[model samples]
Target chain A: MITAERKPLDEILSYIKPFKRILLLGCNECVTVCAAGGRKEVGVLASGIQMSMLKNGASIEIREHTLERQCDPEYVEELVPIIDSADAVLSMACGCGVQQLATRFKDKPVFPAVNTKFMGGSDRHGVWTERCQGCGDCLLGVTGGICPIAKCAKQLMNGPCGGSVSGVCEIGDEVECAWHLIWERLKALGLTDQYLEIMPAKDWRAGGGSGPRKIVREDLAE
Target chain B: MKTQSNLEKVLSGGHLAVTSECGPPRGASAQTVVDKAKYLEGVVDAVNITDNQTAVVRMSSLAGSVLVKQQGMNPLLQMVTRDRNRLAMQADILGAYALGIDTMLCLSGDHTKFGDHAMAANVHDIDSIQLIQMVKGMRDEGKFQGGAEIKGVVPKMYIGAAANPFADPFELRVMRLAKKIAAGADFIQTQCIFNIEKFEKWMEGVRKMGLHEKCYILAGITPMKSVGAAKYMKNRVPGMDVPQELVDRMSGVAKEDQPAEGIKICLETMERLKEVEGVAGFHIMAIDWEEKVEEIVKQAGLYPRPQV
Candidate 1:
């Protein structure tokens, strides 16, 4: 589950104020698990928006629909009829889904209801934390299971900053130092010696910093 | 006109403040959001727009509160410090304030996996304690974060925090409550309290610790309508206990009387909780059963607490 908090309601409402009828599309994938846009949430947001619009004397028609996975075109295509009738679309999916909808229905406008925060796992039942930055590299072996790119306050690849106090980040005293987490993981895996292996400079190519990155599995190619 | 600054007057003046919370529907449209909030208009003192209440993302609390505000009601934006750093929290707080939401409930939200999203990552960017401290700092220092000063007075929000006395190892729950009060929580709403006897004992302990002197505590009252609901609540809800007595009672009741029985239980709980000292009020969470709240409140004799 990629836990995401909803963006403010006002910002979301403002996006659909001008439209009379809007398609509220929810995704059952990452955004659903993240708590941003799920089927039930779509109901709540759609109903809330409809009531508010009515209260303000704006006649907005809200159609509710949820896709199995919005990131895929197959799921996005299912929303064609739902979106075809609405004035615009207020998608509760991640950025990927929203863009996919926009591309699929170039005539229809698509809006995002959530700000995709990060790629990670739940620390506990209801708390979702950012643990992976999607850096597109494999470095968890040497530094333990933790990824310094995502967990480190400074994204320090080499080691912990001296500013670390009792394993908490100094910049924000509340956060657990990523390096500390890394060290703990190393100790747990008996890979403490691996930390001593000096690594080369990070190659930014994998991270899509240069351009949109692509991965092609040779075996999958026809 | 009671401003946030004049909240003490409002609280002291014996106004039975009515507050309701909204869990954003799981989709993008606002109809469901608006419907719940609109229903709450004449029923609550203010509507609490939960920020992904229970850690499942639906609509943003700030956004939900904004909708409530548009509906001509005061909106208390429930904020969880779990997903955001100080920067994001402060920014969102400022944004919410600018949008006219003056009340904020500071919470350490549910662990992310508990809600609809179980596999999501958690951001312990700042805990509840540090969060209120930051809000208070922003309020008093007139800083817009980055230690820079904002142009006029920064809005002071009515700050509330959560207290779960029913959670296991009750002593730890008490300590957490004390921490929230010390963190500048102006009011406290307890977790869903099914057992008033247990809660009353917890209250006595709370009084002994002098936790009541610092903040106004609101007891949480949830109506359990059926054995199925009870089972789900007990089996699914973490750190929550729906007593077997009530479960047994529901099981014994006729199916038609199940909702009424649940309402009966809620009414009794509220009545009992009122007897607890230092208890300022009750927060009724119908949990999608908002329509029955008025009946529960009315049957509980909470009338004269105006819907306006």
Candidate 2:
């Protein structure tokens, strides 16, 4: 799921300060699963903004709404009535959702209330870690199911990068070395021979190198 | 001849090539760079100019390299992937080359959180390995990263990269060095080494792979000025492996004599490392104690770098 965290109160407050009526938009897809931009977060953010505005003796109204998925145009069109009544829309979704809302509501000033972090799943309740870099090329099979592109600090194709100590990354103790985990998994699987096979240089153009990417589906296109 | 850089000549000549670092001043002044270069002159083959090392804002390495060149010393400009994207980096490579700078060290710089500018946005458009490959392509193929042909001469530089023998999963260090060498790094300068035993173990791995023969390998050495300095590196610096015994050695000494003792430890490390099978040279990173480099080199009997 796409994960994110709410922007700081001050930064969010500054974005909506000029507007009198604001809509706190949330997404029910990835952001909801990640607990970042969801119905619950929308209510909490609305109440916090209201309290902050009240303390400042400023008159501001914030309405909360959650779409099934903001990335879809059909779900985004559902926001027309509330968005028409609001002066600005603060999206509590990932960057994709925010851009979707902005594209659908061209006249309304749409702003991001949360910073989209990465594409990852929760390791446990209330704890999320990055598991993929959307490198556009997958090597999990060769890597013993570990994603070195996202997990390794240097994204080394064949490495623990001289910075892995005791299975932990040099970046910090909290981060585990991706290659260390790969090596252990490979050893357990009796594929230790593959460890000596050198990985060739990555073709970054397949990743996020050339520019913004797009996918074309001939079967689904109108 | 790797574009005629003196450091390249020394390393290719099979001498124990000596290189040292000279950080650019925090303020806009060329005097500090010139003065520091003087300390390294004749004692080392070349001087590495750090690029906003530790993420602190300072005089740019490109500008500082030009200043070092003016002093008749070769400058190994350190380029980090943290600040600029491919366009700026490629342009700077061309500009630096045009200015007669013939060597560069590719690095994924220290995170900005470690510096005063903690809030600065980092741009890691490419990592150091890619940077090495890109520079190699530019030099050998005369093409940009996107395959655009350069209309004029390409930057011909002796490519360099860093390694950390202390950082863990210790067995993989040599493999990583091999990767860098495969990516076109002509030389390798390691992080500060305080644990000689650990470093030699790493060197043994490198020799097993015969990687030292693929590229020049220089062991990094930073002389600790005091016990406080030793503690600071052990506690604060990431990936720095300062063995507890060295700290004890410094702590056992009188406060006033710690500096000399620090020099002795460095001298000893160089002497012992000289015997390591794959070791090709010493990269002295005195870090504000540049004055001690000459003595360290002389006492270690590595002075009079062969005039190639």
Best model per TM-score? 2
As a whole number from 0 to 100, the lDDT of residue B132 in candidate 2 is: 88
What C-alpha lDDT values do all the predictions have?
A: 0.73, 0.88
Off by over 4 Å in 1: A1-222, B1-9, B116-119, B144-146, B306-308
True contacts kept of 1: 0.00
Candidate 1 CAPRI level: incorrect
lDDT of 2 by residue, B233-306 (tens): 99878778999999999999999999999999998888889889888898999989999999999999987779
Pick out the ten consecutive residues of candidate 2 chain B with the lowest summed lDDT.
B167-176
Candidate 2 CAPRI assessment class:
acceptable
DockQ of each: 0.02, 0.38
lDDT of 1: 0.73
> Which candidate leads in DockQ?
2
For residues B94-183, what per-residue lDDT tens digits would candidate 1 score against the true structure? 888888878788775765655677677666455565566668767877775457887765867878887766654343456556666766
Lowest lDDT block of 10, candidate 1 chain B: B1-10
* Residue-by-residue lDDT tens digits, candidate 2, A1-222: 899999999999999989999988999999999888999999999998999999999878888899999998999989776678999999998999899988888898999999999988889999999999898889998999999888976676666655566888766879999989998899889987676666655677778688989899999977
Enumerate clash totals for all models, in the order shown.
55, 3
